[model samples]
Target: MNPASRLAQISFTAGPAALLAGWFLLRPIHGEAEPGPWWTAGHLAWLAGFAMFGLMIFAMRGLAGPVRGGRRAAVEAATVVALLGVAANLAQLAIALHAGFTASDGEQMRALLSQARAYPGIELVVYTPGAQLFFFAVLAMAAVLALLRRVTTVSAGVTAAGVVLLGVATLQEGAGTALAAVGMAVMWLGTLLLGRGPSGDGLPATTPTRA
Candidate 1:
């Protein structure tokens, strides 16, 4: 693989690492009463992971270029857009949670939640449907990659399963979400596989051939 592809692979790996860290940090204290420093740390970790994943998604688009097929570019583009949208919402949520948790006491936290609820319109327009779209968009990318033989069949299947698990996570909370995080961690491996080129296109430090 070339330098760009090598970098892409590295970024892809980082994406999942960040996400897993975030989930680990956040899972314990999520929605718990008497939130503490760990709760804030968890949210920050999760959001940071999501932001890195967004960058990885963009990097993967370049790695995906060699594999040519029907609408490959379009699918990749849509995935970038959708994933960025997901990242944006994650940031928003993290901010809200941090603000709420930092409030002086219970009364202040409740007030913050109340004020946030007043803006349901934002969620309606963006986060609500956008997150669902992001899930399908990622699944679509996996399908396209599979069709193009850019990714292995098993990778595609795992990707699809991961997306579904994440979607299910949205509806429920607690253990189910943790399970979904595990599935997403698996999907990250699939993404790592996808980042590498079959032809060694992105390996670094190739010796030039003399004529």
Candidate 2:
């Protein structure tokens, strides 16, 4: 494969893996109100995960490359929505990390979460609509591209499957990390298929033109 394709595949694969790592690393800090120094490690792990996720977004943009007409417009608009959600999620995580590290006592951390939920702002917004939009927007884009035959069927199907896993993961307790990990793995496979040329793999990188 070309260097660009290699990079995109790596980014797409590593992004979710980083997130899974973060989740595992942060497990220790889950319910601990007065967490030890280990909490710092958890926070840092998540930060790295999110950063990698950002890189994944960049790589995804590269995959899309150039576009024209309605397809271009759709890709651009959906990308914006996904980016917004990513930004919001990062901001909320930053706030939580800040609170966790700086607060003198558990009371302070508790207050922060309480206030965040009480107010209509980043904290609540991030996990709610922001996260939802991030997943749904990507799903929508994949669906649209698949229907238009602009993207590989395998890529679209895997992404849509991942979306379902993520949606279910979000609702269940203690399932987020595992579900996300599996989902991302599926997406990685899809992305891998996308990067493969017809000569390298039987799968068509693009749908065949109908006569």
Candidate 3:
């Protein structure tokens, strides 16, 4: 195992776990009829696609460490997308809190929602972190998987999976619920991945190989 692998694994785990945990724990904000544990789990699985996205960025950076390559570019792109995700979720939460999701059905609630929805551009521009949070939730699965695959030949695919998560963040609506689920998967898997490694000073792989 090597130091770089350890850092990579840790970073991957942290990013995804933070994302998913935050999401499932707050699904009520999404106006879902039932936001129970089962629903949250299923949601987490779905969002895992996006949470895995950071891997594409980091993998490139990992493969091209200290040197800018596709990974560096990917990292840059993912950063922008991640920022949007954060912003979208925050904004949505603010709006929902202000309007009160509990009051969405009546005249007052409808009025507020209408105001926010009227100019869709306004919503997107300011963006709520909630939107991206949902997508990030499920990404955990990929991060953990990538860490597991670190010592194997399938790392490339795992890395690509991370990229896909990021890609969805960029192209889709500010879908925070999806991000949250994915992020959770990454967190659990990532922690396990870390535990599976050497020790606190452990490395993830014996040698770093090109994909």
Choose the strongest candidate by lDDT.
Answer: 2
lDDT of each: 0.60, 0.62, 0.45
Model 1 segments more than 4 A misplaced: 1-7, 27-35, 66-73, 97-101, 174-176, 197-211
**Over all chains combined, what TM-score does candidate 2 have?**
0.74
Could you tell me every candidate's TM-score relative to the true structure? 0.74, 0.74, 0.42
Lowest lDDT block of 10, candidate 3: 150-159
Q: Which wins on TM-score, candidate 1 or candidate 3? A: 1
Better of 2 and 3 by lDDT: 2
Ranking by TM-score: 1, 2, 3
**Order of models, best lDDT first:** 2, 1, 3
Tens digits of lDDT, candidate 2, 27-66: 6765355445655665566566566556655555444545
lDDT of 3 at 160: 38
TM-score of 1: 0.74
RMSD of each: 5.4, 4.3, 8.6
Model 1 gets an lDDT of: 0.60
